[model samples]
Target chain A: MRRIISILLLGIIALGITLSLAKIPFGTPKTKVGRYYIDKGVEETGATNIVTSVVVNYRAFDTLGEVTVLFIAAIGLGAVLTTGRRKKPERKIEPASLVLYTGCRFLFPLILLFGAYIFVHGHLTPGGGFQGGAIVASAFVLTYLGCRERRISERGSKLAESLGGLIFVIVGLVGLAVGGYFLMNFLPKGIPNFLFSAGIIPILYIVIGVKVGSELAGIIDNLIEESE
Target chain B: MSFLNHYIYYIGAFGLIFIGLYIVLVKHNLIKVIIGLSIMETGVNLFLISIGYIKGGTAPIFSTPEIEAARMVDPVPQALVLTAIVIGVAVLALALSLAIRLYQHYGTLNLRKIKEQRW
Candidate 1:
């Protein structure tokens, strides 16, 4: 009975969606704003990657809010898992295979470097802080799987998280002080297609990358510790 | 045949959305419901990306001088999806943590068994 009711509900919702979606034709230019961003984004923001320009430059305040949301979720997860916890006696655990431990130790630093590379090249490439941060977090997950005894330093991850957010806010405030608006592109936008160009964009992205990476790693750490 | 060519992405995306909805609605396990929610989020993200598709268009990046601005897909939707994906991950992690707490309290992940969770 419950399944039938839910199927009926879904059928109705699907009908409504299909009817509405048909009116909005596929494969066409729908927004004037998107067109404008593509045409002038490089010249204005000195970021060859238009999406990066849109995220870290055009809608930076919105990005700040997004970061805050992620931070709150992390803090909430930590709070939810840690409160009123009873300690359990540690159980004897078999060590990971030698190959697994050695492989993780070897690949961890390489993965971290690749993630840093992605965010640092945000202005000139397809990726940005969020993608890079996710990569970094995945590395930590691998560490947990292969090196059971090893743990991330809680103080260090928290410090990185706080510092990352602090730098982002500080940059925006400095931009506001120098210019009239929040997150203004106050620094010189050098020639496009270069790593050092796009001024505060790369800086903001690098900050976001660090912040998101540490926050996600902290979340993973919390979940792993709770399970064990 | 022509209709299928244009609406394939829309169809696929909505198919995912409906399947996710069904799972969330019918599944008794809290973890299954969370997985369904994640699938729904993926469908929504895919739908958003498909909306910005332009015929014969390339990515929105201006990596080289030859890439034409007029031929690039809309950057707005891509940017929006980027934000959405990160937010989705955050929400998923939080939900999983909550599920962990729930399981600990009740010793079972079945939502039907939890009286307060029942409608």
Candidate 2:
């Protein structure tokens, strides 16, 4: 009975969605705002990547709210998972083989470097802080899986998360003070396509990368602790 | 045939969304419901991205000198989806954490077995 009801509801939803969507032609350039951003993005933000310019410049405030939502979720996860611990005896997890351990140790730093590279070159390339941060978190996950005995430093991760958020907010405040608007591009937008260009965009992205990386790592730590 | 060619992406995305919705509604396991939620989010993200496609357009990046701004796909939806994906991840993690808590408290993952979970 429930399955039938669900199917009926879904059918209705699908019908409504399709009927509405069918009017909008496929694979066509729409959205005047998007076109404006594409045309003016390079000049206004000095970033070769229009997506990056839109994300960190035109819609940065939205990004900040998104980051806050992530932070809250991480905190909520920790709170929910850690409450009223059962105090069960810790189950022993078998250590990885010597070869696996050595390989993971060797690759860890390289993965971190690659993640850092992605966020640092966000303005010039397709990758950005969020992608880079996920990569960094994956590196943490790798370490967790490969090294059974090792644990990430809780204090250090928390500190990095806080500091990253602080940097973002401070940069925005500084922009407001200097440019008379919040999140304004107060600093000089250097030459396009260079590592040093895009002013606050790259800087904010790096901050976001660190914040997201630490938050995800912390979430992983909390879940691991729960299962442990 | 032409209709199919034109609306295939929309059809595919909506198919995912419907499947996700069915899973969320009919599944008895709490974890399955959360997984469904994630799948629905994926469909939504895919739909947002598809809305930005320009048939023969390139990405919105200026990777080369010859890539014209007029020929690029919309950047807005891409930007929106980027953050949405991260937010979705966050929400999924939170929901899973809640599931873990519920399992710990009730000692069961089946929504049907949980007395208060009856629809």
Candidate 3:
């Protein structure tokens, strides 16, 4: 009965959505705002990647809020999982295979480097802070799976997370002080396609990368600790 | 055939959305519900991305000097989806953590068995 009711509800929703969406034709330029951003974004931001400019330059305040939401989720997860923790009986665990351990040890630093490179070159390339941060966090996950005995330093991860957020806010504050608006791109818009170009965008993305990477890694750490 | 060509993406995206919603509404397992939520999010993200699609359009990046802004797809929705993906992950993690707490307290993941959780 429950399943039937739910299916009926979904069917009605599907019908309504299909009817409405049929009017909005696919594969068309629909929004003037998007067009404006595309046309003016390069000259205004000096970033080769228009998405980066949109994310870190034009809509930076929203990005900051998104980061804060991620931070809150991480903190909430940690709090939820860590509270009322009791001692668990230690179970004997087999060591990981030598091949697995060696591979993880070799690959971890390389992944971290690639993640940093992604965020650092965000303004010039298709990638940015969030993608890079996810990549970095994946490295941590790899470590957890392969290197069973190793643990991330709780203090260190927290510190990095806090510092990342602090730097983002400080940069925004600096921009506000200099340009009269928060998160203003007050720095020089250098030559396009260059690494040092795009003013404060690269800086903000890097800070976001660090903050997001650490926060995600911390969340992973909490969940893994809880299960084991 | 022309209808399929035109509305294929919309069909696929909405199919996933409906499936997810159905799972969420009908599934009793907490983990399954969470999985359903994830599928729904993925569907929504796809829908948003497809909304910005331009026929024969390139990515909205000026990586080369010859790349024309006129030929590039919309950057706005892509940017929105970028943040949305991150936020989705955060929400998923939080939900899973709550599920963990629920399991720990009740010793079962079934919504029907848990008195407080049952509607």
Task: State which candidate, 2 or 3, has the greater lDDT.
Answer: 3
**Cα lDDT for residue A62, candidate 2:** 91
Q: Candidate 1 clashing pairs?
A: none
Q: Kindly provide the TM-score of model 3 when superposed on the true structure, using C-alpha atoms.
A: 0.97
CAPRI class of candidate 1:
high
lDDT for model 3, on a 0 to 1 scale? 0.92
Writing each residue's lDDT as its tens digit, candidate 3 over A8-59 gives 9888888998888878788999999999999999899999899999999899
Cα deviation of A69 in candidate 3 (Å)? 0.3
Better of 1 and 2 by DockQ: 1
* Reference A-B contact fraction recovered by candidate 1: 0.91
lDDT of 2 by residue, A114-203 (tens): 999999999999999999999999999999989778889999999999999899899999989998888998878888888888889999
List per-model TM-scores for chain B.
Answer: 0.97, 0.97, 0.98
What tens-digit string does per-residue lDDT give for candidate 1 at B1-119?
99999999988899899989999999999999999999998999999999999999999988889888889999999999998999888889999999988988999999999989986
Global lDDT scores for all candidate models: 0.92, 0.90, 0.92
Q: How many collisions between residues are there in candidate 3?
A: 0
Q: Which structure is stronger by DockQ: 1 or 3?
A: 1
